[model samples]
Every structure is written in C-alpha cells, then in structure tokens.
Target: MNFFEQQDRARRNSGRLLILMVLAVLSLITLTSLALGVVWQLFGQSHSSLWLASDGAIGLLPSWRLVGVVSLAVIAVVLLGSVYKSLQLSRGGQAVAERLGGRLINLAPQSLEEQRLLNVVEEMALASGTPVPPVYVLDDAGINAFAAGLTPQDAVIGITRGAISLLSREELQGVIAHEFSHIFHGDMRLNTRLVAVLHGILLLGLIGGFLLRGSSRASSRSSRNNSAAAIIAVGGTLWLLGYAGTFFGSLIKAAVSRQREFLADASAVQFTRNPQGIAGALQKIGGNLYGSQLRAGHAAEFSHMYFAAGISRALDGMLATHPPLDERIRRVTPEWDGRYPHVASLSLVPADASADQRAVAQGWDQALAAGFSPASATAAIASIGEPSAAHLQQAHQLLDELHPALRQAAHHGSGAQALLYGLLLAPVAGLREQQMQLLQPLLNADLMSHLQALEQPLRQLPGNQRLTLLDLAMPALKQLGTEQAATLCAVMARLIRADGKVELLEWTLLRIVERNLAPSRRLSGHFHLLELADEVQVLLSFLARAGSILPEQAQAALAQAAVELPYTGLNLLPAAQCDLKALEAALKRLNQLQPLQKPRLLKAMARCIEHDGRIEVAEAELLRAVADLLDCPLPPLLNTTSAAQVG
Candidate 1:
C-alpha cells in the first residue's frame, strides 16, 4: 500500500480501537456496578440477612439508582483519564521520549556512535523528503528503538545504548528506517492513541488501588467491623474489575501492534533494499542477553510503540507488541537458517564511513538522475513515502557535497538560525542591504557575524539544495525555546516582505520555518475533491503562474491540472486572487481532502507542474512546498536532476 492507503488503514484501525475500548468500558461498568450492588445489599440494607433473609430467602435487589450512579462515575473517570493523557501526549513525541528517560543527543554529538546515528538519520530524512527529526538515546542496555509523534513534523527517533554500541552502521540504519516506516505509514499517531487509550483503562486500576489502600487504613482506625468490612468489600471489587479491564486493554494493544510490526519490517527492507541489514539487527537482538527489553517503569504503557517488545512479562507470548524475533528474521530473510548471530559490542566508528563517502561521489556520475525528467502524475503519487537505493545514495552524496561550514552550522541552534538568515539575503545589493539592516537590531553581534561570514557560500548554493539545508537545520531549529522560535519567525516574516514582493521561495521558506516551530496537525480528511473547488482553483492557478511566464502558458497549465480535478466551473484564478497569502489559506483547507482525495489532488498538482514540458528550480521548490504544507512527503530524488536543468 502507498502512504495514503496505509493512512486509511491506520484510520480504520483507530476506529477498531475505539470500538474495543467502548466494549471494554461497557463490560467494566456492568461488572463493577453488579459487584457494588451485591456489596450494598449485604451492607446498607440487611447485613448478615442479605445473603439469606430471616425467612431463608435472598435479600432485595440493589436500587437501580445505585447502579446508574456507579456506571456514570466509571464513565466519567475513564473519559477524563483518556482525554487528559491524549492532551499530554499531544505536545508531541518529545514528551514521550522524556517520559521514557531519554536524554536528547545534541546536534554536535559527543561521540562517533552518536555522529554515525545522526548521519544515518539525516540521509534517510533528506532522501525521503521528510523533516530531519531530532534523535534521543536511552541510557539502557536494551536493543530496541521507536519513532513517536502525531505527525512527521514533530516526530523523534529513539534508540537504546546497546543497539547503538552493538549494531553496525548499516544495521543501525535498518533499524532507524523501520521506525521511519512507522512515521510514514501513520502508525505513530495510531500508536500514540493506543498509549492514551490504555492509560485511561490503567487509570481505573490506579484509582481503585488508591481507594482500596485508603479504605484499609480507615478500617484500621475505625475499629468498627461492620462498616469497615463493607467499605473494604466495595474497594476490593472495584480493584478487581479495573484490573480485569486493563487485562483486556493489553490484549487490544497486542492485537493491533503485532500486525503493524510486520508491515514496518517489510517497509524497512524496501527503503534500504537490503533485507540483510535489518535481518541482521533482529538476529543480534535475539542473541543478546537483554534482547529488546527496557527497564523503564512506563515501558508497559508504551510497549505498542516500540520497534520490539519493550517488556518481557508473564504471558508475553500473548501480550507482546512485536512478533517473535525468529519469525521477524525469517520474514525479512526468507532463506535464513533460523540461527541468530552471536552478538558482541562493536567499534563505535563504522567500518566504511570514509569509504562510503568516496563510493557515493564516484557513483553519482553513473546515476540515471543526470538525465532525469519529471515522471507522470501517477508515478509521482507512487513515489510518496517510498525511497529507493538510488535516492539513498544521492542523499549520501548531497550530504558529502555540502560545504563543511554549512554542514557544521546546521548542527547547532544559533548557527542554524544564522544559516536561515544567510539564505534569506537577497541577491540584489539594495534589497540585501535592506534585509541586513532589518536584521542588525533583531540579531545579536554573534549571530550577525555568523550569517555575514557564511553569506557567500550559502548565496552561491543552488536553489534546489537550499531545501536540503533547511532539512538539516530543522532539528536544531526545533531546539529553540518558545520565545526564541517566535522571535525567529517574526524576523523571517520581515525579511520575506522587506523587498516589497514575496518571492515564492522566500514565502515557502518562511512557511516552513513557522511549521517547524510548531508543526501543523493533520486533518482526518473527510472533505472530498468535489467539495474544494475554490481551493483547488487557487492552488492550480498559483502553480500555473509559477511555472509559466505567458498568460496562455499559465492557462494551459491550469487546464492540464484541471483535467485531473474533475470539477465544474473551474477557472484559472486571477493572479491577484491567487497570491501567496491566498495560496497559504487554500492549502490549509485542501489538507482536509479525504485520504483517497489527497492523492488525487496531489496528482493533479503534479500534472500542473509537468504541463510546461520541463521543471525549473523555483518551480520544483514551489511544488515541494505545496506538497509539504499538505502533509504529503515528496522525495527530493526526482528533483536532484531538476537542479542540473535550470538551478
């Protein structure tokens, strides 16, 4: 399945999860209410005579009001707990990582292992045209990893110390790709929901346990046998019901999680196109003593989010979030002999780091990318969430090609901000001076000097490569405090408008900067293509104008895109109506297009970009920006050649 199809499936799975949660809650309510009713009958009404009345018959039924009250209270508690947790995690994956006892690795990492890990992650992110996520390492001996967030913008990758120390660079890449697959396929959001839903179910047990403990202490003080016994009975029953509900919740999580693990493993193979890389990682995990287990107390809470089962508890065979290691290995490498490798800690520096760089540089000349042209719309749609070996190699080469100063700058906070300022400086001397003057007061002496020192190289950089620079800078930019990020956005906006016209690239860069500060949340996509005529018109109109100089040429482009749009009364919107401001608002509305509808719209946009018979640097940037703002990942691979064409 493509990203859209996978997303649709995730949505369906979420629906299934909701149904299961409702059923579990209903079961708890019934069982808890029934238990409480019996307890109430034995105490409030008849005491010793409740089980068998004085006449030797059973006591009266507990009042319906009591059952109703108990049920309502349970519902309230469950809903409150679920909502609270969902909101807590809504802050994004950073919160989840912190809770797992993860320490964020700085951009300028302290060791070879961390540097290697970050390199692999950056290459993957650029190749896939996804934002480079900040990575964190857990100080644990477990061989495991995970990707967590509601969307790619806020996603973070996490790996354990043992995995980083033990696995080869290739194997580590495989594992990281597996987690990226989760991000691409919409599983991160689903997994986050699972954590929240299960937390609610688990909360009931916590509340019950607290009540039971409090009641026991109260009973000790009261020295009243009858009242204490009744209170203890109620508390104990609630605890049992809550625990039973949590048991079912675990079952739900295991069922949903296991199937997705298989999909992710398969996707990792497709991403790297080397089954052995990931299979080898799995083999080592099996042979290692700690395996994939984590010592974190909350491991069980987020087990379903892990790349492997994070907890090895009793009944793990039934409750484990991941499939057995042997099964996973066999699936990835069908010819496996069913023997796991004997794992041992390896050198921190990868064997081929230097050799790989030389290989990428040499291989680039032979790549088919030099003669590349934009593919058809369907082909473009197929490339979404899928990156090939060639793309990976090119990503490697791109990193290698970056100026050392530029590359190093992107790895730190102030340096990254300086890079952004340097990229925004206009080529025209007057406008550039205007921008520099505008920046002089807002920026510190250090930041101003940094940008000025780096100006020539950044300005000399090709337009196609600027986005790659932005991708590299995102992780550090995300490290900015709220006030700092806000200040940067304000500065970026002034910089973009200082020239009296918003260049498409400038507008795009500013939008991207703002998004990285606080990534936009995705819509559930209930709206369809037919429902978004005005928004479609605005998009096609802007795209048409972006690629063509002539009115007739723009019209042709608009018509080509509109052919795929399948709507009535569509027109090439006036340039005044389709300005950057309007296009920005249009994209927000268009993002609501249904899962199936999104690909259709994206394909139509692809049609517009292809209508001119060629792609340009500015045009490619515009297309990429639209795709990104709409939450669709478009690989930079196709357009690596776009640079050679006009950039």
Candidate 2:
C-alpha cells in the first residue's frame, strides 16, 4: 500500500481494536457476574435448603441491579485506566522510552557508535522528509528497536545497546528502516493506543491482586473465621475473573500486532531496497543467544513496538507480537538455505568508511541545479513515506554541504535554541535591531551571544538547508523546559511581528518549530470536504499569491487550481484575506481533511504553485509549511528540467 492507504488502514485498525476490546470487557463482566451469583447462592441464602430446594430459579441468578452496577463499574474502570495511560503517554515518545529504561542519545556523539546511529537516523529523516526524531539507547544486550509517539513532531527512535554493538552497519540500517516504517505508516500512534488500552484491561488484574493480598493479611489477624473465609472467596473470585479478562485482552493485542510486524518487515526491505540487510539481521537474531530479549523489566509492556519481541514467551508464543524468526527471515530472504549465520560480537569499525565522498558531493551539485517539475513534485509528494536510494544520496550530500558549525549547533539543546533564534533574525537593519532589543531582555546573555555568533553562517545558508537544520534541531528544541519553550514561542512571534510584515519563510519556520515543540493544538473535526471548501479556497489563494509576483500571475495560478476542484466558480480571495493569521486558521481546519481528501488538496496546491511552470524557493518553503501543518513530510522538490523523476 501507498502512504495514504497506510494512513487510512491504520485508522480502520483503530476502530477494529475498539470493537474487540469492548467484546473482551463484556465477556469479563459476564463471567464476573456469574461468579458473584454462585457465591451469593452458596452463602447468602440462609432460610432455604442447601441444594436447589425452595430458592428455585431466583437463587441461580444474580440481582439485575447488582449486574448493572458491576457492568457500569467494569466499563468505568476500563475507560478510566485507558484514558489515564493514554494521557501519560501523550507526554510524547520520550516518556515511553524512558519508562522502558532508555537513556537519550546525545546529539554530540561521544562514541563512534553514537555518531553512526545519528547519521543513519538523519539520512533516513532527510530521505523521507521528516524531522529528525530523537534517538534513545536502551541499556540492554538485545538486538531490538522501536518507534514511539502520538505524531511525527514528538516521535522518537529507540535502540538497544546490543543492536548497536552487534549488528553490522547495513544490518543496523535495516533495523532502523523497520522502525521508520512504523513511523511512516502511522503505526506508532496505534501502538501507543494499544499500550494504553491494554493497561486498562490489565488494571482489573492488578486490582484483584491487591484485594487478594489485603484479604490474606486481614484473614491472618481475624478471629471471625467465617467472615475471613468470605473475604478470601470474594478476593479469589475477582482475581480469577480479572486474570481471565487479561488473557483475552492479550489475545486481541497479539492478533492486531502480529500482522503489522510482517508488513513492516516487508516495508523495511522496500524502503532500504536491500532484503539481505533485514534478512541478515533476522538470521543473526536466530543464531545469537540473546536473540532480541531485552533486560528492561518493562519490555513486556511494549513487546509489539519492537523490531522483534523484547521478552521470551512460552504458551503466549501462539499469540506472539512478531512472527516466528525463521518465518520472517525466509520471507525477506527466500534463498535462506535453512541455516543461520554464526553470531559473534562485532568489532568497533567505522560505519561509513566505505561511503564514496566524491559521488556524494556530485549528488548535491546536481540536485542544486535540478529545478522542480510537475513530475518531480508528484514524486516528492508520493515519496513522503517511501524514501529511495536517490533520496538517501541527496540526504547524504545535503549533510555534507551543510557547514560543520551549523550542523554541530543542531545537536545540542543550548546551541539548537540559538540556531532557532538565528533563523528568525530579520535581514533588514531596523527589524534586526528591533528583534535583538526584544530578545535581549527575554533571553540570557550567553544565548544571545551564541545567536550573534551564528548569524553570519545562518544568513549564508540556503532556503532548503535552513529547513534541514530546523528539522535536525527539533529533538533538542523539544528538550527545552516548558517555560523556556513557551518563552521561545512568544519571542519568535514577537520577532516576526517586529518586521512589520510576515515573510513566508519566517512564518514557515515559526509554524514548523511550534508544531514540533509546543503542545499539539490540532483542531479536531470530522472530515467534510464540501464543508471545508471556503477554507480550502482561502488556502489555495494564499499559495497562489505567495508563488506569483503579479496580480495577473496570481489569478492565473488560482485558475489552474480551480480546474482541480470538484465545484466551479472558486476564485482567489483578496490579498488582505490571505494574511498569515487567516492562512493559519484555514490550515487548522484543512488539516482535519480525511486522508483521501488530503491528496486532492495537495494536488490542487501543486497546481497552484506550478502554474507558472516553475517553483521558486519561497513557493517550495510555503509548500513544505503546509505539508508540515497537515503532518505530511514533503521531500525537497529537486529542480528538475523535465519530468520522469520517479524510478
């Protein structure tokens, strides 16, 4: 499936999960109620004879009121538990990684392994046109990794120490590609939701355990043996029922997770275009003693999120989160010959030593001269979730072209803060002075000094490079304290306003940073394309005007876009009505468009910008900004002279 299909499928899977979870809960309630009724008949029916005497049908059944209350209680507990866990995880991917004993990998690498991992992740991000997500290291001797987060902005990649130390560079890339598949296919959000919902179902088991423990302690002290027996019976019953619920809940989780793993494995091969890389990793896992088993205690909770299962299982093997190891390897590498490679510890070899420096430099030079074409635009959009070898080459060359100082600045939190400030600084003398004056009071002297030092380098940066730097700095910027982040947002807005007009690049930078760093303020609404026509028109007009230098040009661009619309008579909104504020509001609503609707909207946008038969730097930046708002990562539109860009 393509990117849009994957998104739509993930949404449908979420609905399927809900239906299954409800059924599990209902089953638990029924079993628990029946158990309660049996207990009542055995103990509470004092006046009637013991063995089904005068009590008749009434004795065998639970009270309707009791059943109602129990059902309500079960529903409330499950919903509340799910919501609480979801909220906790909503703090972002970092929370989930840390909860599972992952240590954040510093951007400034202290070790060769760290540097190699960062480079791989950066290349993948650039290739796929995504912000570079933070990487975390789990201190475990296991070959596994996972992606986590509610959205791309907060997404994080996690790897175990064993995977880094044991796997070859190619093998590691394959594994990272697998996790990226999860990020690109919208699996991370669903994986997190599964974690939350399972927590809710498991809460019943936890409560039962607590009740049994409390009753056992009370029984030890009580002289009223009969009352003590009753408590123990009730506790045991609840415990049994809770465990029974968890059994089926896990089945549901296993069923949903298993199929996705196979698809991700296939996508990994497709993404890297190297089946042997992934197939080799699996073979090593089969041969190695650890075989992807994590040492972290919480590994079991996120088993499905991993590149491979993080914990060992026995009977649960039937409900495993990943397919059997041999089966996976065979699928990826059909000529496996039924033999696993001898796993051995890896030497500390430099990962990219074999990379061709000359070829990489040439790639960048060629990409610079290549202008955007309609075909290139389409390929760039389609390549959202699927990065190819060319994209990888471009990403590599792009990294090489970036100034070392600017690149290094993107790795650290303090430096990243200064980098952001540098991007927002105005070129005009008056506006620059105004912005500096406003910033001096709000920020400390050290940060201001850093920003001033980086100003020249940042100014020399190209439009595309500036965006890549912003993408690189996202993880570090997200590390800022809440107050600091809020201050940064306010200061950025102030600086933008200080210029007396909103430049497209300035506004794009602000939107990208805030969307990634600040808490998500996604406008929630149902997808209704017809209802959103005016908002769509406003946005298209903004794009049309932003791309053209003259009123007639803008009108011409608008006309091109109108051809793609389902209805006629859509005209360009007035320039006054297409300001940044209006554009922002329009985007918030447009963002709620259905996954299928997004392609049409994006196609219209492409028509609007390419109407003059060229895409300028400013127009490309605006396109990237809109894509970012829609949670889509558009690759840099290479300057191609003609179409046939896709291989």
Candidate 3:
C-alpha cells in the first residue's frame, strides 16, 4: 500500500482504538457509578423511620455519610487503577521499540554480496523516501528474517547467519525485499499497537491477583472476621473476571495479526518480483535442525511478528500466528515432495577467506543463476495467482536475472538516491565534510559544546538510536534551505563515490538520505516525463472535493484516481472501500469537523498539487476524483462565462 492508504488505515485504526479506550474508561466509571448509586439509595432510605431499630441505635445520617465516603474512595481507587494500567501498557510498548532498535549486532560486511544486502535495503528506503532501517545479523543456525520497529524511522531488519551462508544473493534479495515491504506499509504501527493492547489485557489478570493477595492478607489481620471475609470474596471474584478479559485479549491479539502475515508475504513478492528467494529461505527453514525458533526470553510475546515460527514445539494451530511450515512450503512450491531439500551440514568456515575463493564462490553462484531457465523455475514453482506461489517465483526471477553490477547500480544512482540520503543522514559516519562544515557554522558555542558532549555517546549508538539522532538533526538540516540542502546531497554523493567505482549499495544509501530531506522530490522523475495542465483550478478543486468524502467514499475516489493516473496501477478502489466499522468512524471524524473547515482542508490539499505552476493531467484528475467523493462541488477549471471577469 501507498502512503495515503497507510494513513487512512492508521486513522481508522486510531479511531477504533480511541473508541475502545473510551468504552474501557466508561466501563470502569460505570462500576464505581453503580457502587455510588447503591450508596445514594442507602442514604435516601436511611431518612425513613424504618431504618432506625431503637432510640439507642446509631443515627442514620452517620451510616449514610460513611457509605458515601466509601463510595467516593472506590471511585478514586478504580480511576487511578485504570490510568496506571493504560500508562503501563504504553510504557511497555515504547520500551520494546526502543530496546529493539537500540540493539547492537556485530555483522561484518565481509563479502561484496553481504554488503549488497545492506545496500539494497538502504536503497529501497531511499526509493520509498524513508530512512534506512537498522540491519542486524542473527548468528544462529536458523534461516529466517524479520523486521521490527514502532516507526519507519526506528525500524530494524534482522537475518540469521545461516540465511546469509546458505542462500544465493538473489534469494537473499527477495527475502530482504519482503522485510522492507513491512517497513514501508502500516505493519509496524499495527504491530506496536497489538503489543500495547495485549499488555493491557494481560495486566487485568495481574491487577486482580495483586488485589486478591492484598485483601487476603488484610482479612487475616482484621478483628471483624465476617467483614474481612466479604472483602476477600469480592476481590477474588473481580480477579477471576479480570482473567477472563486477559484470555480473550490474547486470542484477539493473535487473530488480528495472523492474516496480515500472508499479505506481507505477498507484498514482499511484489517488491522483488522473485519467489525463489523467499521459497528457498522457507525451504531452508524446513530443512534445518534448529529451524526458525528464537530463544529470546520475550519470544512468545512477539511470536506473531517473527519471520518464522518462534516456538516450534508449542505448535497449536489455534495459538500459532504462522501457518504450518509444510503448508507454507506447499503454497510456495506446489510440485514439492514433502521431503526437505538436501543441503549439506554447515561447517565452521573462515570469516575472511582468500579473495580468489570468494570470487570463485561468487562466480559459481552467478553461473547457476544464469544457467537456470526462468521457464524451468516457473514450472518448478506454482503459478503466481496461487496465493504465494506466483509472487514468490516472480521475486526469485527478478533477483536472479539482474546483473550483479546492475543490482549494485540500482542501490546507487537515481533508483536508490532518496533511500541513500535517508541513510547517510542517519549516521554520523555518513555526514560529508562540507555538510558537517555547514552544520558547524549554524550552531552557537553552547550548542556545539552540547554536541561535543554527545559525540562519544552517538558514536557508540546502535541502529535505531542512530536513526533517532538523525531525526533530531533534521530540523537543523532543514534550516539549510533548498540550495544548501542540494549542495549537501551532492557532497554526500561525492563522499560515497570518493573510493572510486561506487558500489550500488553506496549509491542507494545516498539517494535514500536525499529523499527523506526533500519529500517534494518524490514524483519529480515522473513530472519530467509527463506533460501537465497549465491551470491549477482543476487539480485544486479535485483534491478539495476528494478530501471531503466519507470512509465509503474511498472506492469512488480510488476509481477516479486510477482513471487519472493510468500507469501507476494504484488499487485505490479496493484500498478506499474499508470495512463497515471504518465507515462509521469516518462519519464520526467528519461530524466532529466544522463545515467550513472541511472545505478549507480540501483546498489546502488542492494547493499542494498546484504548488508548481502546472499540474499533470494525472494529478489533477486524481485530486478532483477524490474531491468529488467528499461531497464537495467542483468549481470550473477555467471561467468561460465571461472573459472580462477572467481578465
């Protein structure tokens, strides 16, 4: 999915989450409110003569007041408990993202091929106009990969050592591309959200346990045994109810995430146009003794998000997020004998083999890739439309067919320019001498001192923190303006090229860095090739109208965009037609907006299209189509009624 679709998904999800949160809050409120309602009834009833047993009996007002005070205390306690639970869940999720991102992995870019994997990942980030995510090598025997992060800026792609050693470069490319697709789409955010929601759900059980233990202790020490017994019983009941919530929450968490894995697999195949890479990787997983299981302490908590099965032994279909390995393999390769491929057992190889040996290995792989007929491979794998099979084949073909030099070139030059920029800016080592010079002049002595203090810590930082550091530095870089920014990019490119015979990975990295700094440059390549409309009115009105559409309006808007941007093949209609629940949410957000503001919002979007003097026909058409669905009127592209008025 594109940025717009991802944003719409996020907006819808956020709205649903907010509603869930409100309901949870109300549920807590209702519990206390019910308790208060009981107190109020008791207070009102105490005024009647029937409440008093005798003249010596305690006055009813005192008992009513005592009851009211207890109700207030209950409300306060419950509210505080709810707030604490929310905060704890949020904290746990952030901690996970930060810790995962900040993790260090000792991966040597030993071979040109391994370096290329880094370059391609970096290149894709540039191509997509996002930062290069941190890369880590898992030194395990398993052949698996996974991407993790709360945001694109803070994401990480990790692969096992076995994967690197066993798979050909083409196969690795397909695997990495699959992981990158997860980064580009809305998967990261949803994954993080799942972590938080699951934590909250689980905490209910913890809370119940805590309260029950405390009440049990208090009851043992109390003089009034019956009253103490009553308190313990209530606490025990609440605890049991909370456990039920936890049970359902865990099921929901696993269910929601499982299907997305299949979609992610498809997206990977789409990005790389190769199936063999992923298929080979999966085949390797099935053949390996260690398999794809992770030994990390937090394995089960993150099971749903891992690239392969984390807990191999605990494989229940109901709880397992990943489908069975045989099923996955069969889906990718229908002609498969259920038996595993005959991969020789791995031996301890020298980390730095002779240059001649490396070249021979590389040559052997290249010859194999060249010799294999695409048609033969296609026959070996299932057709593309067969769930995962066709897509996996395409990815493999794309990876295998590309010349190593061209693969490297794709990492550098125009194809990978933006992603390179994002990566270059991501780390201190990537900063060009001139870019640093420009930056140094802008900061005051105190800030420079602060920078000096930070330098050591920054240098020691891991992938995610290093990216975060880049984000922190962005506002300062933005201060450099267009001309200076362009100059900085040129300097970065030269630095990357300084070693002579620039590698494709290096070029891709530079490109990604440039794009992150200048998002407006995203469609610039297309703009150069296409003729555009001279008037801004058409584009502006179209976007304005499209922005006002209901959730259900996405399909119509997408259909319109598809017609406008003919070649892009943006599956807008499918993307726009969200589930029914999403429609209600869109209506809610629309309802909250002031009528005047909605039009203004549309106009602002229109203005974005009209920033350049001319708008391409595709751009204008897409904007207007979206605007039309938003229930807004389209003004004339040009006034034809009166030339005098136009003048």
Clashing pairs in 1: none
Which one wins on lDDT? 1
Which lDDT value does model 3 have at 66?
A: 44
Alpha-carbon lDDT, every model: 0.82, 0.79, 0.46
Lowest lDDT 10-residue stretch of candidate 2: 357-366
Tens-digit lDDT string for candidate 2 (1-647): 87777887888888888888888899888887777667756776332222354747433667776678778888888889899998889877898899998887756565677777888888888877899999998877768899999888888999987787777778888998888889988899888888898888778778777877987888888867666666677678877877777777777778888888898888888778889888988888887777888888788888888999888777667668888988998899888898887776544323342332232222222133334665566677877777676676677767888877778788888789999888988877787778888888888888888888888878777766777898888878988899888888888888888868778888888888887887574443358678798898889989988877798888899888877777777787898998888999988888887776777788888888889777766677678778878877777775542123334
Better of 1 and 3 by TM-score: 1
lDDT of 2 at 507: 84
Relative to the unseen true structure, what is the C-alpha lDDT of residue 580 in candidate 2, on a scale of 0 to 100? 86
Model 2 misplacement above 4 A: 45-59, 346-370, 429-434, 521-525, 639-647
Candidate 1 residue lDDT tens string, 481-536:
99999999988888888878788888888988898787767778788787888889
CA deviation > 4 Å runs, candidate 1: 45-60, 345-372, 376-378, 639-647
Off by over 4 Å in 3: 1-102, 105-117, 126-129, 137-144, 160-168, 213-235, 312-315, 341-647
Which lDDT tens digits does candidate 3 get at residues 1-647?
43334434544665675466445534543443344344344434332222455676643222445445544554455445546544543432234423333232212355653565564554344323244455666566666677775544346677766676766666676677667666655566566666555555445446657767877888778757664555555455445545554454555555656665666666666555566667777787787777776655566666666677766543266666777767766665677778877655445433322221322113212121112211222121111112122323332233343333323323322322222233333244544444445446554564345444444333333321222223223323433466766876776665554444443334433433454455321110112102222112233233333443453443344343333331333333222343223333442343233223334334444444444333433333333323322322221122122212323
Arranged by lDDT, best first: 1, 2, 3
**Candidate 1 residue 604 C-alpha distance from true site, Å:** 1.1
Candidate 2 local lDDT, residue 404: 72
